[model samples]
Target: MQSKVTTTKEKYPDKPITFIVPFGAGGAMDLVARILEKSAVKHLGQPLVIINKPGSAGTLGWNELVTSAPDGYTIGISASELFLHPLYGTSRYNYPTALEPLAQISSTPVIMVVKADQPWQNATDLIAYAKEHPGELKFGHSGVGSIPHVVGETFSKSANITLSQVPFRSAAEAVTALLGEHIQIVFINPGTVKEYVKSGMLKTLAVADANHLVDPVFANALTFKEQGLELFYGNQFGVVAPKEMPADIRARLITGLDAMINDPDFKKDIEAMGLQYEYLDTKQMQTQWIFENKKLTNAVQESGVVELIKSQKQ
Candidate 1:
């Protein structure tokens, strides 16, 4: 019988791999995909060609990915939207079951921020002010069902406060609202707010991670855990192929991704982009997908976010 390694070699031989990014070019996920392509080709012996398919909050690209041939030639960069979108009834594919987990590439925490002139100084103060004026303070997020939306909802539930939610087309737009004082707060990626924070236009209330981010701009910010909330929310980027991919091909892809994720240069480049290089093998990635889906489903159901999201879509 031919070994798995030999089988993968025979399958690919020299055909270039098609990599799909479920987002537009120049996003963090796209950058990660491109960074890995540089080193992954060296290990897999096939160049990775990136194709961006952005729309419907990444569901369009995900549909393209799961519907593609499961020959290991087409793979996509999966994000938190993989789980959130399905729960919101926006995606047709049941992500955890439809996609074969190859490997987890990177993860980044959501940083909650407010304009520098806001009265609240920390999460505790923010929660207090929110509780005292429930449904009065408004927060902005990238979209109705995005990670930031879920994080804001989860935070409100944990603190027993009700803050109005406003969804925008992107994080940059949400930040603009915050800067204009149109919103009291916003949850955004650390990298997006780093410049504003540096210019003293915004102040970070807390990061939704167990520990503060390592980036100098957010290194001093406290975490939700430190503030006595067991809240952690962030975006995870990974690679996935159709569920029926050949075992040998899946193994080969996982091996190449693992090697690229662990490379020193890869780590530096990812961190520079305000993303942490954390590698999870196939098994771990599968477990994470299941766990995250359950958590997100519960949060959306309990918070009535699903109804809110559906209303927004109409």
Candidate 2:
């Protein structure tokens, strides 16, 4: 049943609100959720309950949130790319109409990386090499439906190479695999690989953006597009609720989210991740979600990963 209290001020006046984080503790999504939890609770005069549901590249827990009641009692922090998972390949569930977009919390690049001493000097060199040896190149990602996983798929379809995809549990795990030479390449958040690039532990091949990430790593690293590739852009994350929620309730949630988006603390935190405060309202989110779903479907059809994504459903 819908909560009798429709406003954030009204509904959350007496009790805590639960925010489901689709990744494990201490990861990027988790970190953002924790901070926002503090700010949101203070703003709303209620506690924000953060529950971590980590598995299946974040799909496992996200599915849980989507299936929850449409009342404003439950909310979720999830990545934008997850909407692409089922279309990209296969999964047990879909991002249901029960969920609505509260806001896009922040955006980050899915960057391509390699061992510091790899033979390739730039993305072009890597592409040339991969073209010559398709499927021989190995790349790592957090999991089959992760941003990194889709990023790899996007790059391969654009470049027409058969780079093998390896899925790990976290960005740290994928980076460690790269360091240990267990994998030759992987797409990761800049923060996850920044220390390694500084210490000569890894090399940044290209960022999914048209330009390079200049903060933790300088912009000269090179872009995949500059290498004559056809793809650009990567994943971002957001806050969402059930789709059929009342207008007033949606406004209340967005109000809370907008306050946090404009707050100094949230800005600083996102900047530290090499991310910008690019928030999307429900309409923008829906439109983009549809567009991305199409791209993912095409990619999956081309890459032959539909069955793989299907088997990963938890």
Candidate 3:
């Protein structure tokens, strides 16, 4: 039985692997998953078939991943949400318990943006306006308990201001609402708004990160700390699998993901999309997730988002 199990693990994936993307097609995560699929042929000697399972602010797909057979055949892409959703009691599986960290593919700084036509010029300008108007300024995010939503909350708390919160199904939808002037502001990754900023449709106020964006259009945007606010946060994208996946198979999958992420062409593709090519191996990924979880826990309490969400539900 032991030898049989060893042989089965050695054979590993005799067929195409199912790569589940916990978001809609054409979204950033989906695009990243497709890029990995392209690299899989070179690194894993097997094709990766992508399936979109977007819903419930990404919990649907994550639940799917958590429930899938603990074989190397099933894997999925995850973002900050993997550690975040469970905090708000949305997901049945938490990061440390239900999923095994693979390798992080990329990271991007979150930026505060508004329609270029709005009067606010920078983070200070927006905060001042929001202070006087209180809850009048509507702020949109991907969803409650999502990265953007938390960032927006943290920023509001740090700045001692108030803004109305609006939740959308996805970042793309929030961006669309901002474009249509349905919302006055949004906190999102710089890559998602790069084109809009260049086209003069949206203006970035501050980046909630330590470093400024490398892209020329966003290079001038200052960090929140630089603007006198003590807030820093961003999103990290990575792969994960069911926690009980066999060890040998898990090792094989990690090896493939490491090779695919480190490929020069893959880095180029990631950068071209305005995402930073930040790679973290399995152990490093787990450490980073834990670090983020600690930070987010504090933010959740300080921002009072839990109470706010509960009140809204009522």
lDDT of each: 0.83, 0.72, 0.84
- Compare candidates 1 and 3 on TM-score and give the better one: 3
Best by lDDT: 3
* Model 3, runs deviating above 4 Å: 1-8
Off by over 4 Å in 2: 1-13, 128-136, 157-162, 214-218, 246-248, 298-314
Worst 10 residues of 2 by lDDT: 1-10
lDDT of 3 by residue, 1-314 (tens): 99997888898877889999887776678778888988898899899999988777788888999999988898999898777677777677775578888999988878899999999889999888888888888899877777888788878878888888898877788889989988999998776777889899999999988888887789899899899987778889999898888778988889988999999999988887767789999999989988988887787777787676656645
lDDT value for model 3: 0.84
Q: What is candidate 2's TM-score against the reference?
A: 0.83
Instruction: Report the lDDT tens digits of candidate 1 across residue range 1-314.
Output: 56986765566636888999876665566777888888866778788899987667677888999999888789889888788887777789887789887889787889899999989889999999888887899999776778888788878878888888997765777888899989999987776677788889999999999988988878899999999988788888888888887766777777777887888888888787777677898889989888888877886788787887787788
Q: What CA root-mean-square deviation does each model show from the true structure?
A: 3.8, 3.5, 2.1
- The candidate scoring highest on TM-score is 3
* Worst lDDT 10-window in candidate 1: 5-14
lDDT of 2 by residue, 1-314 (tens): 34544444355436677889876665667777877876877566667899987777877777788778766678888676566665644455667344666677676777888887889977778878999887889999877777688678778767777888888766777777888888899787776666677778788878777766657554677777777775555666788875676666667667777887778888787767555567777678777667866766676666665655556554
| Candidate 3, residue 268: lDDT | 84
